[model samples]
Target: MGQFIQKTSFSEKDFLAFQDKLHQCLEALELVLERPGFGLGEPSIGAELELYLLDGEGRPVLENQAVQDTYDDPTLTLELNRYNLELNFTPLPGTGAPFTALQQQILDNLAGLNQKMDPWQGQVLPIGILPTLQERDFGPQVMTDLPRYRVLAEAVQQRRQSTGIRIEGQDSMNLVHDDVTLEGACTSFQIHYRPRGQDMVNLWNATQLVTPLMVGVSANSPLLLGHRLWHETRVPLFCQSIDGLNSQSEHPVPPPRVSFGQGWLRHSLIELFRETVQLYPPLIPILSDEDPLAVVAQGGVPKLEELRLHDGTIWSWNRPIYDPCNDPHLRIEMRVLPAGPSAADMAANAALFIGLAQGLSEDVEPLLSALPFSYARTNFYRAAQHGMGASIYWPNAHQNSLEERSLAAVLEQLLPVAEKGLIQVGVNKEEAQTWLSLISDRLQSGQTGASWQLQQYNRLVGNGHGNHEACLQLLKAYCHHSNANVPVAQWPDL
Candidate 1:
């Protein structure tokens, strides 16, 4: 999605050409994957943090372009909304102290961006959904003035006619929009893991299995449009926001553009790319110059631009990535986690997620057999809706049956698994212990980002602040603690 194109429109011919290219890319990917030395390197991890730019009143501010103009950092880029910006960190090796390095990178980059925002009296926040955002904040006008974003908006609106969002939690919200800008309200801290080609299947399956547990512990973005929605409102908000499938159509509808997935991946990672190309129609079908088949024949890596762009359009919680930059490789992009609370908190979330995925992959077959994929899907939504308070079904080896267990209790049992996974992946013992302890502490305290936000909001509201005012005050306190880089578990109550 970061690859930029100037073209704003695509014709029928363009779509046909792009579709052909996608198939060719898949063929080339199959051959590439079979090569002896392909993607054979030490494991590495990277992340992209999406954030909100806010004004003195704790509302969204449109200054991403201005920040880009004054700030000379290439890692920082504009998001779908002008009020949002994303920071891409350099990939670090899994060994030594990658999580600690990630934490520092976040602090350094965010500090530099905040310094530039000082001139505009603007502040940067790394939350899933900014609670103060109003209905007027979204629409055609709020979209970033980029060709990709504009074309994406037009493409989704064309397919769905209109996007309707109906979320029922502590408060209910039912609204509709003609454009996909509502997706801009949700931000995330996406983690990228480049594993050896042999471990791809196990790692990918493990990621899916542990996602619910990760979401439960790392829950954030509880409030949206001041409605106090799901503990992690970004999950449903993002899915319903840019959904392209129209139920009114008489033809059979495809899976949603944003989804957990239809079912568990059976054979290889190639199955994912094939399913993506076959099931989902091309949204932005801009043809690339490279012939992937020709590149593969010449024993060279193909950029697979069309397949990548198409894959980017499909918002899977765990998406497969094929990158030809530097050395050609495949990576699993974990898109389930939200941004913020603090840099340490974000790093801790990543550590637990990556560690658990690695640890569980060793025995993933039995785990998957014990817990059905449908139950895994159910657990994901339940975790998002209830956060730490949610009870999930887990494989109880002792009874040889699936047992309903508290999310916190499940996390407690999984902490050691995560730690061992981290060590297996080459993360130093001290680094693994330091980061995993944060998760343990958070679970013990029952104070995830969502819980803290809810508690603070309720307290302020009880003290006579109006809903909107409480949101602003909560955001103010949030920014203060987040800027201090304090863990969410340790943040003081308002």
Candidate 2:
């Protein structure tokens, strides 16, 4: 709960005891749901933004981890690679247009972060993929000296089957090896929403249905290793980067740790993790001892260190998460979204999610029964696979290309339902529409960071320039836009 919390190591006894405590946590959650978790009835939303460090040329700027040490902000943390930094925002209490409030916090935090980094000529940037990222950036030496990241690197490398990369399109890149940390080139903007109650069915269905929508509007990872693959290259790159199976296990079957998702979630949050532990053995064990039961027995709060550590190991897009940080009031977080070129964009993405979750919560069983579970399960994959390029097949059952349909199309289509859903929960119409509009306008014009990056990269490559120049230009423009709090359109012609 405080800065630099102690990380617990894995033990079978701790694991089982943690599981028992986890069950206790969930039981407490159910009781609180009857009274509304945390006295803030229904889902309250939050977001996490990941960013890149760039230089004047728009290339990634390596930092002396000491760069952050100078800033003195606890929320500012190092990412796996030195070139990346993650800004963890305090949970945003949703007022419908979460972005309105969320973006202000991001702007204030980023400005503060930049002011701290300014002396080194380094600045923050949000791009699907760092335009200037190269193989040189991924060496083990470049990974931050943090114990957690170092441990994670070794765990992923040891457990991974192969470092399979196949990014082919305007630019082609295919690689297969035993290292996956290179996939760290991909940066994401993750957002979280409390689902009020264990509305698993709605959560699962909305998670699935919004796949195409999430993709259409927020596809920033269009290029990787200087190669273009799908509109959102992060889709393939991220998946293959950490794939943890041997060549013998390559043939398609449900993956053990790297989930393409088994099926729609219809059970408790614990069920999802239970299924995960059953399917994949622990990857990396850590050091820990704050027995959750010990805390419960003492009439004190438990950190659930063992369970939290295990939960940290499993990564799912629409992951079923328990918010033990706020005992008796935990929420699941959706981590599939890519970080953006703008804070407004990120907020819009959150609005659409919270709205859709509200819109679809009551319609789950009927919706799931009517729609294919496979579609819901695989929608996020498709979103990741072809961001803004794939078609979302809706329950009324119509498919539309992300590029062709535009964000407004999805917003117009889903907003009414979202509004109705939110209104049903007393979250007035004006609040819902404000945040949703950012998404609507952004999508209508095909102006996502991914789309903009693809356009600029293509323009550069089409004109016979190497990636070095292309990325440099893109990064420069992106930072300017981010600083101005302006959309990509107002960033002006390259």
Candidate 3:
């Protein structure tokens, strides 16, 4: 979705030509994958942190372009909404103290952004969904003035005709939208891991398996439109916001544009790309001049521009990325985690995810057999809905069956697995411990970003504050603690 296309509307001819190019890109990808040493670089990790910009009163502010102009940082980029900005962090080698390095980069970049926003009386916030967001905040007017975002909104609205969001948790709420701007309300801290080609299948499957645990422990964005929704409201909100098919349509609806996935990757990562091409119609079919097949034959890297643009539209929770820049590589974009609490919490979340995926991949086959793919999918939503309080089905290796377990208890058992996985990936022993210990403390305290927000909001409401005032107070304290870089587990209630 980051790739920019000037045209807002596509003709039938454009769609057909783009489809042909997509197939060509797939052929080129096969050749590239078969080539020795391709995508076999040293493992590394990167991240994109999406944030919300707010005014002094803790309301969403439309000052992203101004901040971008003043900051003059290449890493800072605008998101779907004017109030949102994303920071792209540099990739670091997945060894030694990578998490520590990542933590520092997050802190530094956020500090710079906040400082730049000071002149505008704007503040930067990193949260899954800003609790203070109102229904009026998500209209066509709030979308960023970019061709890519406009075209995307038009495309989604064209397909679905109308967007409806109905989420049920502690409370139930139903809303409608004319465009996809509602998705902009759900910010995330997306982590990227580049693994060796041979390990892609195992690593990808392991990532899917462990996602529920990660989402549960790091759950945030519990409130949306002043309603107490899922622990991670972003999960459901994002999917429903841009869903292409209407329930009233008589045509057979395909899988959602945003989804967990139809099933596991049976053979290789190629399966995922193939599924993307086959299952979803092209949303943005902008053509490129270069012939991918010709580029592969001439021993050159093919950009696969159309394929990448189309892939970006399919918002899989764990998406596969094939980058043709420099040395071509494959990356698993871990999109399940929410954006904030603090930089420390985000780093720990990344460490836990990368470590568990790598560690579980060693014996992923057995684990997958013990816990069916369907179970894994169910567990993901369960965790998102209930956070640490959710009960998920896990593989009981000794019993050779799946059993329902509390998310917190499951996380406790997985800590050692995560640490081992990090060590196996060449991370320093103490570095691994330093980050995983945060997860440990978070579990013990039973206070994730979601729980903390809910607690504070309810506490304020109990003291006779109105819903809006309570949300504002929650955001104030949240920003204060987040800017202080204090972990959510250690945050004090208002």
Candidate 4:
């Protein structure tokens, strides 16, 4: 993880200047001929693990300072909120045994994190959505005193003019949270895979095709404002919660900055940066006169001012990423996954992603030719809204329920291809099986993170333990019960 700066006060003019600089950088691209990224034949691999720092009762814990005190490792760094922490898995250059190594390192880190939290009545839960997360948990006092986060809150609120939440299910909710901390209810398992320069276009398309399936498999955060609207309500909440456009915005409005893009990767990665720079204004600004190209000439890596700044502002689901890399010097960050029940489960999830991304690039173009994109895209929102229970609007004029084109249905068709791709990249059989099986079992049982959480929530509720506070307590208990087991069937139910 890179160092984060403390947010400083900025005038409106500062933001506008940053946007103007970004535009010039995008324009500068047109003057230079972009070349194919250089890389070895080995596949790209990366992972991001988000954890909820919790107390023994499963309530949000602020042991950030203690955790930081215990370790000097930058890889395990503080998140935007004090209750949140993130682990940036080291990049694996070649694929052989890489997943296994990542698993071991992550487990070791988790052990260390748990030990540190123990004395403080704190622990880190890997569940996709901590069932106990509630409004009380995200109040001002809990807000991490970080400049970046402050800037984000102020910037988004100023533009969106509202928190924009509306959940309707067993219960109904329509409230505005002036701040975006409500977005903090989400914690995810993020994965990154390196795509070949020659096939980047196809990989982007395949990722779009698989977005809904991905969300369905990892659905969590089903209950919001005490309602059961969707299995993975995080999707809509995140987009709508931070949307800048006011109600006056008309139809065919620009998509919220966050989205599973309808358009394909038409050109270079620079195109993504350019579109963002052109559409959304900058929210944070810390500018310098240091010429990035001059640094490149000095044999130093150029951080590409425009690209990095624009990257900070616009966050799409399947984000275009540029990171320090030995191969391709860039990788795609798949940001849609929810957190995990156990460390192994999270590792397994990451493995499944690595395999699927590699496999999809080689197989999807022809397979997707006949599939209507609108259904696939819409179904993702539906899954996020309703989780496993919603009826999916079928592709084409023909109607097909989500249960009909189930996540399991899609996985069965695609997992083997992903398996082949993972195997080709040198993952051991057990490594692949340990992770992939979780997905298989979850789909077979139709129990996503959100579903399991809701089930657990109801069990507590029937026991007269129902309330915002009870939900958090149950999350605390679930973490206590499920620690490192990957085989969900063997793991005792909550």
TM-score of each: 0.97, 0.85, 0.97, 0.88
Over 1-494, each residue of candidate 4 has an lDDT whose tens digit, in order, gives 11333546888887777766766555544333243343325565778888888776667787676687786787886776778888888877535566667777678878888888877677777765566667776656666677767777777777775455766666666765666777777788788877544466667776776677677766767776566666777776677667732522443344467766656555556667667776666767767575655554465444555557557667688876765334325567889888766666566667766677666767665545446565666777776776656555433223342334555566766677667767766777776776687777766787766677677778777888757755775565566545644544334446
Better of 1 and 2 by lDDT: 1
TM for candidate 3 is 0.97
lDDT of each: 0.88, 0.64, 0.88, 0.66
Candidate 1, residue 23: CA error in Å?
0.8
Q: Write the per-residue lDDT of candidate 1 for residues 275-361, one digit (tens) a residue.
A: 899999998888878988999899999888888889988999999998888988889999999999899999999999999999888
Candidate 4 deviant stretches above 4 angstroms: 1-7, 27-33, 36-41, 244-254, 293-301, 324-328, 367-369, 389-404, 468-473
lDDT-sorted candidate list, best first:
3, 1, 4, 2
The residue-level lDDT of candidate 2 at 245 comes to 30
Cα displacement (Å) at residue 352, model 4: 2.4
- Lowest lDDT 10-mer window, candidate 1? 244-253
Q: Native-vs-model 1 lDDT? A: 0.88
Q: Residue-wise lDDT of candidate 3 within 1-494, one digit each (tens)?
A: 56558878889999999988888988889888888888887789999999998889888889789899998988889999999999999999998999999999999988888888786687788999999989889887898999999888878877874557888977798876656888899899999998644578899999999999999999989999899999999888887787733532334376678888777778888989998998899988888898899999999988989889999888999999998888689899999899998999999999999999998887888777788787898999899999999999998656545688898998899899999999988899999999999999999999999999999988999999999999999999999999999999999989
Instruction: Name the lDDT value of residue 458 in candidate 1.
Output: 91
lDDT (10s digit) by residue, model 2, range 428-447: 57877776667666656656
